[model samples]
Target: MDKKINIYKDVEALSEGFTSLLKEELSKREIVNVSLSGGSTPKALFNYWVANCKESIDWNRIAFFWGDERCVRPTDEMSNFGMTKSLLFDKIPTIDKKKIHRIHGENESKEEVQWYTSIMDKYLPKENGLPVFDIMMLGMGDDGHTVSIFPHQIDLWNAEADCVTAQHPETGMERISLTGRLVNNSRNIVFLVTGKNKAEKVKQIIEEREKFADIYPAAKVNPVNGKLFWMLDEGAASLL
Candidate 1:
């Protein structure tokens, strides 16, 4: 796996960087499959894309998916699909509804996983018996977790399924998340992380890889036959 690190002065800079990267990726092919993450970091980036790139890009050629989502109604504020729709999707009238593949967060978690896995199999590009996303946008939690995979629930990192049910380590709220193997199969995996509170964990994951690499779930995001990019703001990259 090839890895790259990009540190920005702040969230605004990070958002701009992500937008530029997204545009570049979109221009590379006629159609692109992108998996988005839910978090404040990506929310800002989504807003940037909506305000700037919505009119410029060919939305019809892009397919949207989520890396993970809370088990709540799509109308709920905590819903990843809800946030993305409001911040990005809903604003773009040209985007195709058929291209938006969202997990039924309000449904039973296990069933939702199976349903989403089938959707991925049908829509996403397949390679080596796994769906290969063109781009997978991710965010890191303060606890070194990413895409609903927590430190305590490391088994999900190597799950054979393309998608699986996950639970928050503390709250135990159910979630549907793409398995780590599936995420690693993507063409590009970009992690957008911010906040000073995550500095130490980010440092341990990026700098002290040999030591904490096996412990932090975020550190396990090594894309197979793809590129991995870590886009961090000054706060998150402080300890690095």
Candidate 2:
């Protein structure tokens, strides 16, 4: 139940707010494993870091992973890895390519899930038998989904595996996501959400007054031995 909510004036300020936290964690940890999220808000953050944090932050000390990825070619427009590569990795030539442990979305679903799960086990530090990430970035869908686990698939939050394949409710596109067991075990869980579209669910989850608010995967983002944060822009926090 420990949570921190930060409301920013705009996406620019939101980017600055998260960078402050990221910098603090970087200063404390030798190797920071960050689980990246895909969405417009996070896009702003990746761009902000590449442009503003390039000089101050040491790319060598950080490793990048994704919270989830669509089952598509990495070059596809819907590919989360594609977006992050274009925005952050491509901009920072000094970044070590080996530090990026991207999910092979183009690879067959079952095979890729097993590969990524093993990669995480090998790279991340473990606590309570689960890999612990320094930071797990998340996004809240309009329907209150997070990490590709739709409201209809809320049960997957506590699935047995560290990673699971989730099918998009509407699109039916498959996605590989770090299950809640793994995400909640991380050292830090951050929800970087924006836009007016997110206001309704934001209010509901934060206040817990709306009916079925507990059903949201985003609402269950409690870190057992870590921290939970919701960094929102004015539009997203409007209803709060």
If scored against the real structure, what TM-score would every candidate get? 0.96, 0.97
Global lDDT for candidate 1? 0.88
Using TM-score, give the best candidate's number: 2
lDDT of 1 by residue, 92-125 (tens): 8999999999998999888889999999999887
What C-alpha lDDT do the candidate models reach, one value each?
A: 0.88, 0.90
Candidate 1, poorest ten consecutive residues by summed lDDT: 205-214
Worst 10 residues of 2 by lDDT: 206-215
lDDT of 1 at 80: 96
The regions of model 2 sitting more than 4 angstroms off are 209-214
